[model samples]
Target: MKKAITKRLATIILAFMILTLCLNYVLQVHNARNDMYLDAKNKFWQINQILKQNEKETEQVKEDLKANCLIRAKAAAYILQYRPEITEDQEEMEKIARLLQVDEFHLFDKEGTLYAGSEPKYFGLNFTSGEQMQFFLPMLKDRELELCQDITPNTAEQKLMQYAAVWREDGEGIVQIGLEPDRVLESMKKNELSYIFSLVTADSGTTIYAIDPGTYQILGCTDGELAGKSITDVGVDPGTKMNQGFSARVNGEDSYCVFTDGDSVILGITESNRGLYKDVNSNCLLTAVYLVLISIIMIVSISKYMDYYVVRGISSVNQRLEKITKGNLDTKVEVETTPEFKELSGRINLMVDSLLDTTNKLTKILEAARVPIGVYEYNKDMKRVMATGRVADILMLTEEEARELLLDHVLFEKKLEDIRLHPVTGGKDVYRLPGEREHFIRMNTFSNANSILGIIIDVTEDMVEKQHIEKERDIDLLTGLYSRRAFYRKMEELFKAPEELGHAVILMADADNLKKVNDDYGHENGDRYLQGIAVILRSCKAEKQVLARISGDEFVVFLYQCRDREVLSAHIRELLLTMKGSTVELSNSKEIPVRFSVGCAYYPEDGRDYRELLSLSDHNMYQSKRNRER
Candidate 1:
């Protein structure tokens, strides 16, 4: 029988081990595929962002080229209107070039022959002659049209140049205007495309390549040898239509790749899926070997467990249970061979003693608890059966009086009605007795068998102290307004919401000449001046506004969700007038006028950032003070 049990246990364990190995293999492969797919998706998104940025930059460059071309064309037209008769007048032409802000000027006939140019070396070079033929041939065909070319090498100097041309307004010939390369380099210096498409090679042999769409050349690649090579050389056709994460063979290796079409470049990310999943297969094999070793160990262990101890130990435990069931609470098993069985017997003996001890301890704990606790049974009327631990002291009554009051059903119902609209058995409720009490009682009620038990504690002083501490932290003692930290925190919350900030305005003010007042009168007079300014700010009474004394001599105001900008401006104008007329009387019966340099910045119009808006307001305040001084 024992051998049969051991064989059954081994079969069950072996089946579980097989299931575990299969599940682990599936999960690992699934997770690996998921990770690879997410990585590819992220790379694709990055490529899209880079392409968008490139488009924006290219558009800006086009705008600059158009503006430069227009300026050069207008200059050429002006020079044509006033001709100097000498075709090769180098001194006159160079002067015109400097006035036009161009590197050189070329005058060409309708047949594309250069007549005069700023550079003496190109006095007779024909536009249709040599390297400039392909670009200038079009100008010869359309003599009246104005044109501008992208960067090209200057024939005379062999330096990069940008040129624009327009027909002489009299239709006599074409005049060409050239811009030096230095003027175009600033707009053309962005390398965001190369930075975005740099190669990323994963440990699993995944490789990324950046390809130029115009030349089909590899711009950047994980494979060093492939750089500067054509995509076709690496077996990828630039014109091939492919979806994202398409499975195909790349470079004669099984892989997955995707193409991201950009403004001037094509981005490709490829992964060798076969190389990535090989580790998952190896892990499965390793796990199977471990399971085999563990199965052998457990099978041997189960054989020993069943043969020597399991059967006899279970029989002894059954006998001990029968003795304990027959009113023998002290019964203990002594003939246990294995440690598991010996502990099992010891636990059974301790369980009975624990039950008896728990009952005695519960009674003692109830009587000794400092907080009052009570139990009441309900039938037609409620009766308090037990009360303990300062119940009479908290109730301010004798024990007999407390019991009599608790037994009154109508009085209990009234108290419950005052404390709770809907009574929940386990929820806490606070109740105050009919008196000017120093403490408030907190009670938790629950139903137990046929009775209700309540545990109560007094927690009055804690609530009062928490409120007092919070007030001290949030309020500024000197000005009776919000503290600087509190004002900043509130502003931060407003900045996170765009709509809230849109209707708000920030006001920053500085007390003008506070140092003069302190030096002439005293520091006490300076304090009085600051206090008087605070009073003027507090008298505004605008709803939903926050005023704070943010610095020693500076105050800030946040006017939130104003109804009208003009009304707010008008109100500020009135406040400034009031400030000019207002005076603070000193202890020596001398009156001093209050003046402030005030500035205001509107949110979503001046700035969306809190620090930026504050700085702007402060700058405006200083500007106002400077203007007044002037």
Candidate 2:
């Protein structure tokens, strides 16, 4: 009996020692993982700050380039306007072009005739003739103003140049200068800003890549092999998960990648997380070894002093602890042999019951949550663990089916693939359920070494509401056309760059007798007249044509990509003929025919912006109205 008591006491001592060592090891691991997360977060924050500063500097450089170009053009125009003799002499014009360091130089007469230029081939060209006429004629019509054109090919110079021309203060002619884009860009010296990338030091395992957002091409990188490759080619998605940083595998190693967008480019910094936990893990392993040696010493010393009187009860309690560790929390220690052992057994059982209750409550709360929450760990085999809730409903599966789908990784492979490429937080993606009901789900994700935790919320209603608001905000309620504000917005979108706009025309039209119609037939009748005109305009509009009622009596139509001016005139003529034949009868049975005065301006010939085109067309419309009055 004494020998049995000794053996049981030895077993209990060994088990306690092992449990103490294991708990210590687990605490060390948790601390190490936390430090790693902190290190990664700090690195990302630092890198993103540097990227934002570089972007701001780049934007400032762009603004300075434009400002400096304008200054140079104004100075050149001021000099040339005072000296008309240079326009008459080709030698003088060539000398002036060289002196100003301009790619091309020209002078126009008050009639917009190219009186003299460095290129003799273009000397007789009229500013009001052909496709290029609109750009220069607007200065004449607007009464002697300065103007600048975007980059375009100057066949005379055989290079791309940006043209800036100004009217002579004396109104004699216009002084025009052309700048080589390359020269202007060189003068700005944006390339010097590349040194900013070098300031971010990346160790052996880390990398920093500068990318051109416009082209998604790598401009500079710590790795020479990554240079000239697109962001995608280097395993980075330029279009995916912008602004927010993410974690993914790069070059077969886990890395944290942070992205910062500049005015013209994107900066990506990739950092490896291996070194962050290295020291902590090493120390934990050493400490665990030390604890094992100490535990062995304690086991040997305690066995000799333990007596047979307490052995049976302690063994029974130890057995229950072993069962609890193996997930048998309901098992209680049967320790009624001694009064002391009975109290100890009751306390142990109480602690285990409390732990079990807490765990069950937490599980129920997660199950009741409206948002879908999940964890995915990918190591050897991909495993997904999801909280019980709307996750199954969202996936259009029963709870059991959802678990099966996750285990198979079939239904969610695409989503998982994207997440593997780039882990997203508050990122938007659309998914179709089993019933084909599409939903917009937003995910806020947290990532560790090889695992991701996500909270998904359905935002379909929010998205629909925003779109409806935008539609209402941009449309004119009364005329069923775009509002004045929307007209300008659409024009900005359609005519983003000057080169993209080919043969565009703006037509400004006004009701000729709107005031007379209103006074004679009352305000309600005038509204009917206006609605009738809107119907006609809507009927005449083709694809991509934007028509808007900008004022009470004024309407504007932007005819996009209509190369032939005759086509525009024919359309207007047909509309007039239709209006001439049709009449609106008011409540008094009084019939009135609609008449309109229209003036048109061509793009890249008249002006580039809406203000410039509208001013010219409006002037012409008033002039036409005056002619009709005569």
Return the top candidate by lDDT: 1
Per-model RMSD to reference: 19.7, 21.8
How much RMSD separates candidate 2 from the native structure? Answer: 21.8
lDDT of 2 by residue, 150-264 (tens): 6666544446667777876777777777766664455344344355445556666777777887899888887878888887776676666855556666776766666777555
Question: Could you tell me which residue pairs clash in candidate 2?
Answer: 134-605, 134-606, 135-605
Give the range where candidate 2 is weakest over 10 consecutive residues by summed lDDT: 374-383
Off-target runs (Cα >4 Å) in candidate 1 are 53-195, 199-204, 210-221, 224-241, 244-247, 258-266, 304-630
**lDDT for predicted candidate 2 compared with the true structure:** 0.68
- On TM-score, the candidate that comes out on top is 2
Reference-based TM-score, model 1: 0.37
Candidate 2 residue spans exceeding 4 A from truth: 1-382, 395-401, 408-413, 416-438, 449-451, 520-522, 585-591
